[model samples]
Target: MQVLTINGQRRELDVDPDMPLLWAIRDVLELTGTKFGCGQALCGACTVMVDGMPARSCQTSVGDAAGKPIVTIEGVDGKVAQAVQAAWIKLDVPQCGYCQSGQIISAVGLLSQNRKPNDDEIDAAMSGNLCRCATYHRIRGAIHEAARMLEA
Candidate 1:
């Protein structure tokens, strides 16, 4: 059995250690917020936080995630998360809304470390995440707005 802290809750899972964390999170735990975009980890749809750092759940092995605190979109909290969610809402960042959860997860991770990120930094931080709806402009704008909200 592999033990993990998910969304601030302790869980004991009986699954293959080599199984992808995305499956474990979505299938086992039934937390459907984290998505699977590309099984190869090329996309950020499965993005989650391990120890407050952005990690691609599709590529992250369940064994590798053991002992680390994992935070998914459903578990996002605190000021940074609130600010990001507010900014996303204000900017209407999502079109189809399929990638919004992962995007929001990445944004929360970015804002947690860097209160204010420049355009380059924002681009770099968000590079791995792709929006099929082509909401890049709104995503960038939301990040800046989230930063400003954090500052206030």
Candidate 2:
């Protein structure tokens, strides 16, 4: 049995250590907030926080994440995360809402370190995340808005 600290709770999962964290998160923990877009880590739909930094859970190993605190969309909520979520809502960035959780999670990670990320920086940070609804423009706007909200 392997132990993982997820969403502020500790749980034991009976699975392989090499199992992708996305599987452990969705199947073992039963927290479906984090999504499975591209299981190969091409998409950021499976993005989650590992010790407050954004990581691709689809490629991250459950053993590597052992004893580490994992925060999915359901676990995020500092001022930065809250501001990002609020900005996303204000901008209506999610037409499908399937990718919004990951988008928001990525935005939170970016905003936590950089108070003001320019277009290039935003692109660099958000490059891995894809939205089928093609809400890129609105996503950029929301990130900028969230930056301002964080500063305010």
lDDT of each: 0.94, 0.92
How does residue 116 of candidate 2 score in lDDT? Answer: 98
lDDT of 1 at 127: 94
TM, every model: 0.99, 0.96
List model 2 lDDT by residue over 53-102, tens digit each. Answer: 89999999999999999899888988998899899889888898998889
Error of model 1, residue 1, in angstroms? 0.4
Backbone clash tally (model 2): 0
Tens-place lDDT digits, model 1, residues 1-152: 99999999999999999999999999999999999898887779999999889999999999999999999999999999999999999998999998888899999999998999999999999999999999999999999999999989
Residue pairs in candidate 1 whose N, alpha carbon or C atoms collide under 3 angstroms: none
Clashes of 1: 0
Clashing pairs in 2: none
- Best candidate, TM-score: 1
